[model samples]
Each structure stands twice: as structure tokens, then as C-alpha cells.
Target: MTLSREFKVGLFIGCTAIIVVLALLYLAAGKGVFENLHAFTVSSKSGDGFTEGMPVVFSGFNIGKVQALELNEKGIVLIKIKIPDRHVKWIRSDSAFILYRPLIGSARIVVNTTNLNSPPLDEKKIPEVIIVNDINDAIARIEPALERVTQIADNVERLTSNLSDPKGDLHRILSNAGKITTNLASKKSLVEMVVSDEESVKALNDSLKKLKDITTNVDRILTKVDKMADKTDSEIYGKDGALPQVNVILKDIVGKLQKLDKTIDNINKISSDTSEGTKDLHILRSDIDDTLKTVEDAVKKLDAIIGLKKAPEFKVP
Candidate 1:
């Protein structure tokens, strides 16, 4: 069954055409060529090295791809994305587009629309900026905090080392505490002595109570004494009191005693003089004796009137 050259060539061409058509259908299916596409454009300050054919993810699901990329005159990258019209409702004016690069993967363009109630995004709208999830940048932002933490760790290490040193104040305090504990452990008799002195403690408490009672009694006594002193002072030194009359009487007595002393002095001088006759001298001596008798009789009458017989000794010189 060998065929002619022309027939063989036609058959080969048909087979090749069928294979090419099948290949094209497979390629179209893989590219989602049958799906309805909605065209939109996004502008970003930085594309984060995004190129054409990058997958556009929504909620971790690959929903579309970047169809084209171009830079405008302002040097902003414009990305044209093709998403299925079935997902058009997920795009909103408030939606955020991010060009994120993980620590170990190529850069990606993600679309997030948390509030779908907002107005739908306009066609060919240019996005504000490109946001990248760069771990290096995050770490760079936390560098100062990390440095502060490192410094704090160093200070803690130094403090711990100082606390551990036997010569440090903390070590000394711990040593003193250990010594106190050891002393308490060794001196069981001290605890027993304190425990056995219950009577002394009670005695001390009783003494304190007695002292308080004595203080109270003393205060009452002091109050009574103050009242008595006040009464005595009022009675003694008040106007129209007996003490005032006594003081006046004593002053008058002092004056009278001074006059009597002058008289006695004059009489003594007269007695000492020898210019008179002896009979006149005898008469003068008799008058002096009579005057003394009269003074003694007057003093006796005064003593009887003032009830001096019941009084203590009355010294008259």
C-alpha cells in the first residue's frame, strides 16, 4: 500500500495542521482565552520590578494577569490588567493595589477591596502608589529599637555580673542575710530565752498600766492643787482680804516701832548724862519705871482683846 509522493505530502500536511490546531486550542485554554475579560489600568510610583504577565491576586487566588506595562512622562509605571468580568464587582474605588515581594519570592501585584459597598473603580484609573512588603525595609525601620534592646541587654548583663560579684553591695547584703540566717539557726537558746520571759513581758505591761494610772492620778492631784492654790491666792491677795488688813497693820506697827526705838534711844541718852542731882535722877528713874509698867499693862490688855492667850509665842524685845 505505498502511496504516491503527492498523496504522502498531503497527508503529512493535514496531520501537521491538526496537531497545530490542537496545540493552539490547548494554549488558548491555558491562557483563559474563553473567559470574558475586563480591561483596567493602574498607575504606580514604583512597579517594584513588575513585568508583563505577572499574576494579579485577589484574596490569595490568582484572578488575572498584567497585560502590559509602560511608564508615563512623569516616570510613573502604568500597568494594564485583564480580569474576568465576573470579578469586576470586586474592584472598587477604595480598593488598594499593592506590589508586594516576599522574603523568598518574586514580586506580586495584589488587589484588596475590603469594602465593596464603595463605588466601583473607574476604567483605566491610575493607582496612587505601589506598596511592597519588603522584610528588609521593615527590619531597617526596627533597627533603632533593636539597638536599644541590645544596649538594655548589655546593661542587664553588667548588672547581673555586678550582683554576682562577692565584693558588690548586693553580694554584701546577701552575705549579711546568710549570716543572719545562720545566727538564727545556731542561737536556739536566744529564742527560748525570749519565749521563757513571758512573765517579764507581762510585768512590763503591768508596769506600763500602773504608770498610766499613776499619771492619771497625778493629773487629778495637780488639777486639785491648782484649784486650791488659786483659792488660796484669791483669799490672801484679793482686795478687802485679811492679808491686806494685816499688811496695813504691819506697816503701821513698823512706824510705831520706829518711833518707840527713837524714844528709847533718847531715854538711854538721858540716863547716860550725869548733869542732874541724885534726887532728880531718882525721880527720873521712877518715872521711867512707871512708863515701862504702863506699856506692859497696855500690851497685856491688847493681847486679851485680840485672843493672844490661845496664840503661839509672842516675842517682844
Candidate 2:
């Protein structure tokens, strides 16, 4: 019932080798070693956050891993990805890949298939690299713009501080405007007093009334003068007017004057003829005396016709 030492050591060694082999097989299977794998190369400019053995995910499922990375002849990075044959059909020729690198988390490669009906991606064909922007890269891109924004904020802060200072022009201008508004509001009662003054309104009304009275008086005077002018016109131009009587009387006076002038001329001619032809001077004197008396009577008749109380003294000359 005793075991040999050599056989015991050999048995121990064989059991140990078997356990190690089984463990290795189990690890390989767990890593998809037996699964049919297909590979395609992805070209990129540089390796930023990508590395070997990184999971390539499809629709949030880990379907493959990055197999290797190398630089090609053109200095571009070439990343080879290995996917299982069963999952290879999930990636089509029309598929898109996106690398998402967040600020606080690890980077991941995402694969999307646009058409399930299209042909699967060929292993021999080159894959497209998904360019992604990391947080540091995005921040670097906007650094200059952020600097300008910071300068603008500083200027605004200075302006705000100046506006709040009592010695500043902006503050003084606002204070002056507020004071003017207050002064105008305080003088509102004076404006109301001037507008509501009863004495000035009464004086204006009285002046208007006096002007109306003067106009009425002027109209009445004009009416009186018109009436007087009409009366004067009637007296001078009517059928029984004084102007017609004066005209007739003047005509009669002119005729009497003509007759008197003729009578005096005839007397003068008779006196001159008697003085030359009669030898007796007494008879010529008597004729001259009678003509003088006749002249005196004509003068008296003319005075009576003119309604004179006494005839003017009639001198022979």
C-alpha cells in the first residue's frame, strides 16, 4: 500500500501541469480566443487617447479590441482592430465611428451601422479614424476668445464702479437731472397760480367789452353822418330844392342888372346929345336930374328883390 517516491513526484508534477494548462485555456476562452476573429486597419494622424487593447464598442456593447498600432510610410498612425466573426456583420460598409473623450472619464471608440442591409465591412479595406476633441483641445481653441471676453468684463466692471462714484461725470449728470426734475415739480404751484388768476381774466373780459362798446358807438355815429349827408343831398338836388330857387333868383338878378346897365347907357347918351344941341342949359339939366332919379328907383327895386332893409348908398361913380 506504500507509493514509490519517483512515481509520487511524477504524479504531482503531472497534476500541476494539467491545472496550469486548464487555467490558461479558461483565460484564453474568456478573452474570446476560440472565436473567429476578423481584423481591419484604422488610419489616424496621431494617437491621442487611443491605445492597444482598448475596447471597440458597437451600440454600447464591447464587440472588439484594438489589436496593434503602427506608423505607416506616410507617418500616419494605423490601428488594427479585431472583431469576432459573429459581430463582424454588425459593422457595414456604411458604418461610422466616433471617438468620445470626455473631460473626466476614459476615452471610448463607438461604432454605428447605418444600414443593416448593406454588405459587411471587408477585412482588407481600410477603416476610417473617428477624430474627437478632448476637453483640453476645445479649451485651447477658445482661449483667445475667452481672453477677449475677460477684457470686456473688466471694462464693464470699471464703468460700473465709475457710475456709482459721486465724483464721476455720469453720477453728476444723473444727479443734476434728478435735481432739475425736482425743481420743476416744486414750481408746479406757481404755474397753476398764473393759470388760475381771476383778476387777469376779468381784465381781459372788460377790455373786450369796452372794445365792443366803442365799435357800437362808431357805428351809430356813422349812421347819423349818413343820414345828415342824405338830408343835405335831398335839399340840394330835390324838385323843390333851395338850389333851384337860388338859380332862378340869380338869373332874374342878372337880367335886372343888364336892364339897368342899358338904361344908364341911354341916359348918358341923351345928356351928351342935349348938352350939344339945346341952347337953353336949364332944359338939359332937368333931363339929367330925371335920369338920376330913375337910376335911384332901379337900385331901390334891386334891394327890395334881395330882401335888404335899406339900399346901399349908390354913388354915381
Task: Name the top TM-score candidate.
Answer: 2
In model 1, the worst 10-residue window by lDDT is 308-317
Residue pairs with colliding backbones in model 2 are none
How high is the CA lDDT of each candidate model? 0.76, 0.77
Model 2, 1-317: lDDT tens per residue?
88999999999999999999999999988878899999888777887778888888898888898899888999888889889877888888888877767777667778889899999887677776786768878799889999999999999999999988889989889988897677667654544344556566678778999999999998988887777667656765667755565566667667766766776686577668776865645765676576667667655655564454223332221
Give candidate 2's whole-model lDDT.
0.77
Candidate 1 lDDT over residue span 226-252, tens digit each = 776676566556785445655665675
lDDT of 2 at 211: 100
